[model samples]
Target: MLAPAQSAADSRSSVEQLVSRMSLEEKVGQLFVMRVYGHSATAPDKADVDANLREIGVRNAAELIRRYHVGGIIYFAWAHNTGNPQRITGLSRGIQRAGLAQPTPVPLLISTDQEHGAVARVGRPATLMPGAMALGAGGSRTDACEAARIAGEELAAMGINQNYAPVADVNVNPANPVIGVRSFGADPCAVAGLVVAQVKGYQSAGIAATVKHFPGHGDTESDSHHALPTIRHTREQWDELDAPPFRAAVAAGVDSIMTAHIVVPSLDPSEDPATLSRPIVTGVLREQLGYEGVVVTDALDMAGVRQKYGDDRVPVLALKAGCDQLLNPPNLDLAWSAVLTAVRSGELTEQRLDQSVMRILRLKAKLGLLRDPLAARREVLGTVGAEAHLLTADRIAGRTTTLLLNEGGLLPISRRSHPRVLVTGADPASPSGTTGPPTAALARAFAELGFKATALPTGIAPTAANVEEAVTAAAGMDVVVVATYNIAADGPQRILVSRMAATGVPVITVAIRNPYDIAQLSGFGIAASLAAYGWTDVELRAAVRVMAGRTEPVGRLPVPVPHAEDPARMLYPIGFGAMYRRSGV
Candidate 1:
């Protein structure tokens, strides 16, 4: 004997009530989001996109409205060049116009990974911020939040809504192949505190904020994009390490969550991926934690989801598990058809579909998607690369400067008269090309600062031969600046370590990538080792500024540098670097 259904007023407050107004076909349509990268400047392929028109049955932006109502569109690799933006804007207008073509207007949730710095979208005169670790090391929640807000404003200017940002994972594993600089810091509290600030920053400016890699992908030695990772933490460990930041982000009212592919036996069976796991997404995140927002899956195209499973089973499994949106594959046909099949077969219930559609609609409404839709859409896209945004990038970029070691009190490189300083590390020329990896803006900045920069080609493999060549090259330089681009690779870059140690002369190691790259270098005889945490133009200039004594080195090392250990199995053994300011510096 169940109670009667809620009164009309009570029903109006519910997601089901709002979603029930949509047609069954439109309800199904809301489950799919489509996007294309780097192909939207000229004809049908550029903005209206080939897949959106012919492949997915969306002929133009108007179809997005008149026909199947889409949940959203994800944008990646939009060109900053003026030649392309006009057409891109036209495409966005088409997407908005098409979305409005429906009997009842539906706001398309536009999303992108504008984490700012290395994780940026909508090209510019190039305002690059430092990586998250650089911001964390720089130590200002205010600046981090402002950076995110600025990123949101810029994203909005480009008609982007959801910014998949403020990566909440606290990086605990130095061996992490991908989520190194993206994470806030290793300490969960620190990550939570800063991310909450970023979430507010995004929301304050009217953009929906996304908190990501739920259940923590920070410590995994493997990248989920290539292979599924198995987390070995206990339930208690989850409370300590993984949940805090997410909890904070949720509390801050983030509109969406991006689930990771990592599996944990302690939490669920090894057979289930987190994105499609009820125990994780629905049971844990939704029921127990009470997160009412949309749960977004990491790109379904990745090997972790695509390779491990033989079928396209993830789509239905994830929807049933409580996730609301499936991102990237751009394979809307397969995913949409799969969802339809599941619905028809009763594998995916109408109840579940209603719930997902309702959340999507409510979020869209909340973001002002439905009301005067195109104008709101236009408002957001209008914010891209405004004067204020470019300025803030420089501010955060400047603040991230950290001076790790300056011996003989020789920094702010006193305006010495034509003292030829030889900067040697990754040589831009060579078959293999610089051990420092490919970063052109960085090379240009280093050169402009007047160091006769010579890059030595070195692979990520840490070998003795590479070290000898580097040492021999640097023997005659007045000052040697080694750009150590620490990679979070499966293997070691040991040659980099030996070369740094090979020198007794003033060898200042400037880590251009992961600060964790410095862990092995202490064994090499380096005069001073600094963690630049990133290799963007912002980072390069910040490093130069610190060397030139423009800004005080306020950044504390965010990750523990590795000490002597088996290169095969990395061990972050060194005491994380502290504020070591020289008297004159």
Candidate 2:
């Protein structure tokens, strides 16, 4: 055990020494990154205690650290764990204080899903950087690095040491439900380059960068959160499509790699998900890829990893499969007890536990968390959303406006030619449940650019009443701008767009989430079409700049858009973009 008065710096060089002194329970605890509910370290009220009890069977984060001796804690905005910088920084400091006060006295890794564009856990006061697809469309490795660095600085300021970001998945499947905009792009090489840039960017800012969903999660139509999805890539196909970015990430010296929950039969024929498959996680990621860094599993609470194993068996199987960190297990108590039993029973050797604990400790030391885990509240207040960081975010968002079609030079709509403008569409919440009023935000952007713009809130699937109301509102408008969020082939938003276009008023279609929706508007007589790839204020303003002729469309289609009538035919190729002068003559 560590001496009673020993500081972390005193034993930083001797990780082996610290590990040698740890108890069996402490070693096991160091391998799991559990989730805790509420913003405070200790339970502030019965409500906070009740929420924690419901989620992890713990009373609060302090008890979670003191009792379980957890090595890490992940924050979620929806769990009341984030409000702003002060709250997050204070929570991080409190968690660290609790962790340092423990018998073993090792620092805890504070992590969050601050993936920036669509999946940011920390909201507005922080710089809302562009998403992976946006960066891919921008096609600037420098911007990718700078964006990651800026976001990383903000996260580190808030005392978040680990970030689950720069999703290295190559999004080849257009109909992919989960990873559409989160991935860099469909081209494996391009994705690899951007992944490397982001890895360098994030680590440069003193945050441990994690490249996620190893073996790839991009080609699946099914979401792993609800069910298991199998990627049917052959060994050759896997080497081509799913392996390059992970290879590049490994080469980039990434701090950690998160395993996918999907089963790839080419790698491991056993019907087991990658998180629990020894052949895939151990053989491919460790032996084949030669990755010596920490291997963390995706959330254990998800349905994909829990199909065959019970809650208790899941963590043990993941560790046995060679994962160093078991994240967000459904039943923490059960999982911890099961791992302790496995170690004592020789199903898993203490030596095996030591290997993982050593890796975790090394990562903590590399991130400087071992020396000073607590963040300064005053520094956090000034660094969360610095002016320069927000400017970089705006500049990056400006580079991602991809114009797919502008027939008859319909874009760059002059305020003198078409003075009245109406903006309406589905302002859907992101998959991570971050809500922003994108429709109103877009109108404000347009108005700020000197146009009379009105925003209408038509839900994702516009009802008959919504369509009629929008049409009535569009009667006197000079041009109608509708933002579509991942419109399906048979979605009602198509009807909404077609009806607005039929009114003899020029209509511009902006696919705010995916470029695939632009393919569905072929016969709809839309005057212009472009993809923002996201619906945040930054993206909307970028699109507005392109439409207002203030900026040219420099972003090309990062992923191919299939023909609406035939999936085999391409509507727009991967590098297709229309400049103001390049539109149809």
Candidate 3:
């Protein structure tokens, strides 16, 4: 313990020394966390690189780091689309190599939105664990910890040191379009428990954990990606529901906290979102909550901030609002210039800029990035998506396979009788509205379970004609399993499933993305209901095992499934799950 304490002191000293040497431009640069496509090799030709950079409104990766002295780089779908672990590892290493070549080298914090499940940026190459809501349904902090650890290890191996995950949002609103399955649950205390566990697990594995969308993004009905949403909770209500998990995360020593783009009139009357509100980001999160760690803003390029503040002004405003890092500014050059201008014009003090840069440097030192920024190719090959990691993912998925409703004991479909099944829902190959496992994968899982499963290719959005065709096809099947994606956004799917339920076939509605879908379509004459919470192949297989009686449905609902008609009334409350009992047992 004494040794560790001494090491921490040494790291702090090193960070302070480094900050003392950085120029004003370099210090300002450290506040910006820009985006980059994959490795330089992945860039087509010189012409393509120029064209792509122009299109995305950013400069070259190495040039940005060397010239701007950027603190970090976040990987998006374009960066890791190849789904090759080795290739991704190479890309990460290449970026670090470029950063190291700078005159005053600082290890770049290679980060990604590795939220797992549907929101994973690096898909096949990494272990695709279930999302936070599924892990919450597992009802085991041990499982959440293990899942986060495995994910962290994989990311650390790939030279990525920061994980923006363990969404602490208490998803209370059924109609919340963006944060349904990403959140742990509706209950704040339970979400707090899981958030602390995940933060510890990620940190223990050497990857910094960032509890995201602070002040809670779960209660709002709008998607910040498209528009700003407001949380109309009173101060007392916010303290009770939205603030607990974030408070718990801060207490757990979470390395970073991400600001949401939602507005809360109680915190700040200004129309500015929390990402640009000093009263919320600085006053509430830092001063009131006592969070001394780094505070990062969600993507500055998001429409929530962009539409209101314009690209040039948002970054400067965010920094002044107490955000230490600006993520994915639409135009890096413009954002950087604005920050420089603000500091020069006395709008943002140099001391404030140094304070943030110091925090960032300290975090980098803590992660040992300053010591060895590059990852070894051998370690990347040996650890990423290893068998053990995949197994851990499978275990979490299995544990969280919830049986929400089985009105007539319709589940555990009799394999002995060889039931012919019809698996129709969102197409997994090209999931209709959201990301998850494909419908084809669920059908395949049924086939693997010794059932003659026929899959319909009715895409995610089923037309009225598509529903008629599915109902006509369901007539021949003994049972119908309809997997629903985001029903809040995809209303047509719910309508199609309702029509299928009316066809007199034993309809099993499996919520493949958000569990709240069950609540939306509950009044329909569905025989059974299940919540997979995600559409990952592992999760789909686990749900199939539960249906086939091979694996028990042990998962409880993490968040309350509200009634479609009355949002206040819960159709299936949290902690609800039905266990399968064999007849003789």
Candidate 4:
């Protein structure tokens, strides 16, 4: 899968020798991963660093590298928000330069949550491809592989060597707050197929792919960002539903597996989340599944792990639990000092610390970061978000436009009739607080297709007054398209759409984020239902063409759409899609 680790014996020897020479502080630093900002050319000047200090939480990138010696640096939307390719490249280059400047000069693993689709952290300057669910809807392993390959290429071009992506979680729970659209789908076998392809694709391009939320974050309803979620399923049930994709990932030689914040009682009887549970992380993922690669913890700062374990204690617990990388610790100095102290005392042995440090160094060596950490700025600027990559994204989006329902054949609105289409929708705010377009971009694409389309942006959670206004406004429209962003979770948006459907006009519902929205809104008399899986410009445009009869609705539902009234009942099973036919009648 990955060419037998490529000179495995030599790499191990090098890492062993390097670890032998490192001090306890340096070796401890190799286990912690921290966040740093101000990578872009447009970043505030050094004198103005204090002005933005409260926002970025650090005066400069050098502070973390020089003081803590973090093994990796994670970039969020804030750090690379400027959609400027040159600036993003400069940010990555600068971070690498800082790492290289260390005395021993171990290269930092530059990573981001570039899961493409709705979860992209550095997407503005890179090709914004459809996410895992969208690719699953397309039902083409080839397209999924290509989308990941393109993402890997763009990320690698920008000097980012790791992507916390290809979410291996099988989203079986409709109420899952976090992994809905981020996951590939509901079926374990189907998710495994796509997961393996994505792993090959990313690693083939030289960017390490981290298959996430290991025992599975799919069946749980709670969001780990705020609280700890416990999966009560037995080991047998887990093996049946949750563990297949991860097992597939290991067989594919994935570069990394990100542990979930949720606790699995089946794996570990204790209440510790997988990130801190030695039985789950080391016993199950390593001994049982045989994953020899790196094991990274999901942001330790998240409330799931943070609330249970203090900031000072998480780093040591994570290392003792067999995690190679401690990602996004809340208190860097405290965590570093705790791990150092643990090693100094008998709490954590020196050999245990060396085990993780050696793994981190070996991974760096595998990624060729040890050989050449700096990227050529000229090459990055030229290739990041290149037109070729954008075209690939567009094609994948087109294939992923799923038509879940077409009752009474309401789609393919005729241009001859010059249908007055009223497009109304809400833009769900991202977890990172980023806002997207008010109206689904489909409205603009409708006008481009020669239909008289008007977009009315509604609040995410609309009031009764908002619903009344939208329903009254749709009275005279030939067809009303109600676009929903996570309407399954937002009660007001669902009410707004139901009201529009009650207007006795042809109401076509399009799920702009989660495909499960169609199942939730199926009780309403929707003339048509489509799942774009994401609200990207490419996805929106693709949805418009499918509705306009310009392109065929080829995408199938990746996850089963459960009935709104009864969660166990399926409104539409996975692999469901209606073919569009050209007709004004």
Candidate 5:
């Protein structure tokens, strides 16, 4: 065991001592993760913001620290003015110092879902790397770890101790709404391996990673954000299909486990969601799986929990059921009211709260955010330089690139002969950014490769529906390059692929999402299909090089495709990404 740092030992004891002496009101502070709208505190939008912002105000940090003594604060991005780390530092420090500043103050825990890619809130919506499905397409144990490390370091610098990310939900159902892009893959073992590496990566950077959506939300076709997704799978199915990643993450020593809001009918006959299920959270997670760390609930504000349980009763049920931290509880007043009532009336034993707080506090101390806020802030913010993005972005693009369909040696269109290229899809601009990536870069890299690439502004490809026009265009073109782009909606360019296939041109279809697109567009019978997973600039250039025979198309398909028509093909046929290493496995 590593020698405990001075901060670790004292900070742990300090937190316990402080919790032990706290009165009912003081301990209540530990239960509330208050959301303060930064906009609510600022300008013209203050009226709307103030209505949502909940804070015990008096701008004085020292005074606020002593007053409510909340365990943590959620940072809502101020759209009018995106906050810089420099600006957030003072506010975060003041909130954090409250625990440390007290004579026996306990260090408060700070958490955020800084899965800061295109899907992130605080940063600009840069071209996000394809989510978990994309990662699965490009199988790299290192990629999972590195991506998480980048996320963790950035969060740690922001004075945020926890990342509610590296989503543990296995994306088994292709139609799974909210979690499709968020989950790693369909295979539990693959998801488990990626999750383990990811957790180690983030923790190595001193950021606590949360493996989430417990009891899994992968099989349902419906979304739980608006309504609870009820899965009919038996307990054995959940263990065989859904539990592996969570178990692997737990075995790998993840700091926190987040419960899903979806109802598991097979696990509980009453149909309570995992967040409020005693059998799942306490029995399975704690007793069966032996998870001893923190168990956080998915946002209580979600309709799954809120609509069914009602606002007043959720906190009581959750605390009793074994959830350690309650996320984004709607109507904080109701939550506190319920918890306080339970505590004062002897409904909840103080031992339960102590158990949760101790685990949380131990995590804070381990991350060192509890010890010296200044040093942690400086260390992270300073290291995230431009060069870091430049290098990692390349590796991410290269490794995550997947080769789904390759029919003939049609790629490597010899530049020396000036192959006539008809480029149909992909964002034409390079995904460039100071701190984030833009989606456009994926296409621009081809133009840089000396490929005579033309981008259609209408976002349609040369297909059979417009056969005469497409055939006329293809008559002189040496290669018909048809590309597919993933949108906010499902199944990219179904009609376009049909049209392209009818033209009878040797079309090269590139699947920019996961290979699951094969089920949608594979019937087109395009000679070659590539799953770049995403159109990052690095992957685009690499794809061009491999096509030209300048580089061998060594990248294998990470997920298998049983056949274009098979429903099971959606999970993935193989776990191969680009940069295929011949000798390793």
Candidate 6:
């Protein structure tokens, strides 16, 4: 076994040798991390292949590898890329074979957005750990590290070497549409601590950790997926609020840092987003903070980075801004040609391209992908969603259920007394576009605990008809448990909870996605409220156990809960969580 110092030296030397022998085309391709639609890698003719041909302008995964010479591939569940452990391993092996078959024979870096909680791309059969806010709520660096380590192990088991995770943003704005539960909390120091823990944990599993949305995406009200959002923090504020976690991550020797698409006027006065701002990317991240690792951009397809530039120009701008990887460009052909043209025209020097390519190659070499990037089917199947991993997820989830409001000591209701229960609420899909309705999961969990619990699914933005259906069903129930998902103060889901409260049955509300839902549920007079942070099955089951007094509610509010009416008043401060009295029956 090579010493860590010697292994790093050898990796750097090997990366330099490989870069010296690469063509401009291969070097430029090494800077891109594109997405392709498929389950199988080398399958030449299939529906999935046709989808890739239509979207990425490629026939299949093999064509993507052969034609683009892409340095990385990001797997998305919606792209039909990940199915199960065996399938993912097979795809990884096949894609690696395609890349190794090339004239230069460079291995591809396979990555995914497996941050767990609400933003996981690989689901089900893979271990689903708690999200960032959940870890923050639990407030234990040991738990945070363990969760990330388990996630890294599972991801690596299936041949994914990179994870765009451990969101370092301090979520100061409850109205942030994109990064609410994704962030650790509003406290910079606390967030920094957890981010460092997660980075160490992830890298310990031999997967490269990428701390993301640089400068910070937490305080913005808008989602960068649709429109551009500008952050107006002063240089002092940016240094205090948004820069600590990244600084800590760099200090921890993080492998990569992903740029946010939002514009920070303080970092760069120009209208360019961080992904396209040389001042922010090169000036702040590179020189000020001393992050020598690979710097990847958020998806080029996001409107946040494309507001001013066309598809072809976005990649060029990101590359020129010092980004080592251009992720998920909207049009691969246009972006590829634009970069090639820029280099050929002397607008982007080959030396510049070589710099980014060397960092990327060093990352691949560091992951041992330079030697072997394939996964054995038996090993992957044995490790991906092992029973021990599931238990770890369940234990972590158990630690994150926060009891915010128990007005009448209505929690831990004796299943003996509250024998008749109805589990009904908004079953909304998570921000990642995965996870089914959590109501059924909640109901099943209660049923297993010896209660006659029934579930009635209510859409996220419930209609009058949906409310009436749930209200009518709750008439005979002894207790009602409703889950809320980011409910606005005036949203129809509030009406659903109000009607449930009016039914004269004891009401227990679980905030499935956002903890702020409890503020909206105020004045409706619910009996108890808990913040589950996410709606995954593990989270729901853990909440049920907490409500049943099977486990203690140890999680605190990671983010502050503001008053629904005033918005300025603190309804519950950060780290506030009610505990059950030992004498409560």
| Model 3 whole-model lDDT (C-alpha atoms) | 0.82
**TM-score of every candidate:** 0.85, 0.96, 0.94, 0.93, 0.82, 0.97
Which ranges of candidate 3 are over 4 A from the true structure?
A: 1-6, 41-48, 55-59, 79-82, 375-378, 428-437, 488-490
What residue runs in model 6 are displaced by over 4 Å at the alpha carbon? 1-6, 375-378, 430-435
Candidate numbers sorted by TM-score from highest down: 6, 2, 3, 4, 1, 5
* Tens digit of per-residue lDDT, candidate 2, span 319-396: 999999989988888999999999999999999999999899988877766666764523876787899887888899
Q: Which RMSD does model 3 reach against the true structure?
A: 2.9
Candidate 3 structure quality by residue, lDDT tens digits, 32-70: 887765455244346546644784544456766777788
Candidate 5: C-alpha lDDT: 0.64
The positional error of residue 375 in candidate 5, measured at the CA in angstroms, is 2.7
Whole-model lDDT per candidate: 0.67, 0.88, 0.82, 0.82, 0.64, 0.88
Shift of residue 558 alpha carbon in model 6, Å: 0.9
Which regions of candidate 2 fall more than 4 Å away from where they truly are? Answer: 1-13, 43-45, 375-378, 430-435, 582-585
List residue ranges in candidate 5 displaced over 4 A: 1-4, 7-12, 39-68, 75-91, 94-107, 116-118, 122-130, 377-381, 414-439, 457-492, 501-506, 535-572, 575-585
Candidate 2 displacement at residue 492 in angstroms: 0.7
Please name the candidate that would achieve the greatest TM-score relative to the true structure: 6
**lDDT tens per residue, model 6, 370-450:** 777764423777787889998998898899999998877788887887889899988877544334578988999999999
Q: What is the C-alpha RMSD of each candidate to the true structure, in Å?
A: 5.7, 2.7, 2.9, 3.2, 5.2, 2.0
Candidate 4's residue-wise lDDT over 1-585, tens digit each?
A: 123355888777777777787777888888877776565423546654663365335577766677778898887766532356666667777777777787777788888898877787875547788888988998789988988888888888877888898999999888898999898999999999999999999998898999999889998889999999999889899999999999999999999999999989889988898999999999999999998889999998899998787888887888889998999877777788898999889899998888788778878888888777774523776677788988888888889989988987777777665378998867665433223563646678888889888888786777788788888789789999888877644488888888898888888888888887776675688899889887777778888899888888999988988887787888889888888655573
lDDT of 5 at 242: 93
